[model samples]
Target: MDKNNLTPVEKNKSPLILSIVVGIVLILFLAGGLAYAFSTNLITMPFNKAIELLVPEISATANPDSSSIVTITNPNSTGTIYYTIDGSDPLTNSLKYETPITINSTTTLKATVIDEKDNKSDISTQQFTIMEKTVEKAVETVVPENSSSIIIPEEYQGTWHSIKATGTYNFSGNTYTYSSGGNVHSGTIGKIEPYGNSSTILVFYPIEVNHGFTVDPGEKGDGMIKIDGTTYAVENSDVFD
Candidate 1:
């Protein structure tokens, strides 16, 4: 066709068609540029690295008697710590560590940490053994000649009340009677020795009854410490109470 020979409709459609083709080519050129940049490592995209959680730490302090105070700590300080005392593996639903655990006997403590991202850490474990203190018979004085009873020292004798438990302990001669919790436990004072400043260690041999203390008496006797000549505390019990 010759110039200025086209109709009015064709004249208007020419610019619109040319604009659409130009837009398509520009889009293709931009896409090719982006592909080349990525292929040549010119521009980089943002990346997120995986986060790791830290394991917890277990520590313990053994008391003079057969007991220990166990403490658990985490380095992150932002996550929750779960633990177990029965040597089992710890999980999220296990006992949440909030305070120091008091272990009276031998135990294996296990702990782990869980962060906000649900990342779990390796388990930390510690074993605590509460060894019983032994005293020889010849070192202490025995009473009643043939009987297997030890003399109750004058300071620890007589009726005394426990500051911790709602009980009364009566010591007379070589026998002792402990009354508490709607029951009475009578036994012989098997051993007595001097403890820390103004304190004494007393062991009771229960007579067909279990002593109401942390460690139940077996073949061995139940031990108690008289603190400062006023308060009586059992094994694993807090000091001076």
Candidate 2:
């Protein structure tokens, strides 16, 4: 056969073709290794982790009974928040901030946060004041009923002109007689003048036995006033301090 008319059989054994085939195999092996590394998603993290080490945000609330609730919000999405209250930072194992407080008085509410990467956040505090309790007062008192010997606490027997007793009077107790809201009160002192049961139109003897009365501030009728609400027996005479 002429050299110029190369045959297909000669070309099939060419060294150049073999070399190209070897190169392709090596390239494929390298490419596969690169793909495996990407699939595992390993090398891309630490760099990402570095950015996440930043701090987080925290919020807090307090209740009336001296308790508080701490809420930690993690904006990084890639990290979580760990926090503490007890007036301490996240570096300690102190109580985790949760639940509301029953702050009877003024109190301080605090919160802190930390990410999974040990990133520390600033501490936050809130001051709160609790509502105070109200006291009930007794301004006036009712008189006693069915009493013969009427002795009054000298402190109570005062000349009182109250438009309070207008209707039929109803009173209880044997120690004292007084009136409230248009009701006559009879006590150990028998009956109090002016507000006492209708007696012979005459002057009252021993004006000393009459218990006194005081109108409460900002009240129309006699207010619930008494010496701590305990019944005081007619002192047979003048009741001193």
Candidate 3:
């Protein structure tokens, strides 16, 4: 074989060399494609599972005053809280908890936690019982002189019940009875002081049997009477009568 001319054996070796080079190039291309897919997280085979989302924590309380608001919280979980008041499970499209939820009546609350990745947590449920504040008339009592400076309104001279089961308040003449949670607190109206132009404060003192106890009926708001921490609203009156 001449220096410039390849022998038959040498010609065959050239094809082999080219074949090896092509195989190596193909392998490199396949490797690069796999790396790209892995970097982009497009390949599902490498990951066994995704990180699970944390379940939401819920807190709520029933209010006796019928003005109680519920506060739902999710601790250690960073995400939006979805809730439902109808006792159904919470969904992504459910009402979002932007502020504390104000429930005017009895309700069964459900909530769920959703993370930024759209992972949902287990559902949480809670029930709150609200008492119906109904006003009923109690047996009447005679008014005592010098007990109060203001004339007792007939609208207030009745028995009242808190809708939330907070308790009951009976206003008859110069005395009133407030019972709650199996505990009774009775007092006599010492005086009726002016509050706002539309409301008054019913100053009360414990009876002789329970003397030394001071009971202050805070400023009456609207048509509701508040004794201590409990609030009582008059039930519906006889419309026909």
The alpha-carbon RMSD values of the candidates against the true structure, listed in the order shown, are 16.0, 13.4, 17.7
The clash count of every prediction, one per candidate, is: 0, 36, 7
Model 3's alpha-carbon lDDT is 0.67
Residues 176-212 of candidate 3: C-alpha lDDT, one tens digit per residue:
7878899997766644444323234433443344223
Candidate 1 has an lDDT of 0.68
Candidate 2 displacement at residue 96 in angstroms: 19
| lDDT of model 2, residue 225 | 24
| Model 3, TM vs. native | 0.41
Instruction: Find the candidate with the highest lDDT and give its number.
Output: 1
Error of 2 at 189 (Å): 11
lDDT of 2: 0.44
Query: Residue 78 CA error for candidate 2 (Å)?
Result: 13
Candidate 1 matches the true fold with a TM-score of 0.39
In candidate 1, residue 172 scores what lDDT? 79
Query: Which scores better on lDDT, 1 or 3?
Result: 1
Show model 3 residue runs off by greater than 4 Å.
Answer: 1-49, 133-241
Two-way lDDT contest, 1 vs 2, winner: 1
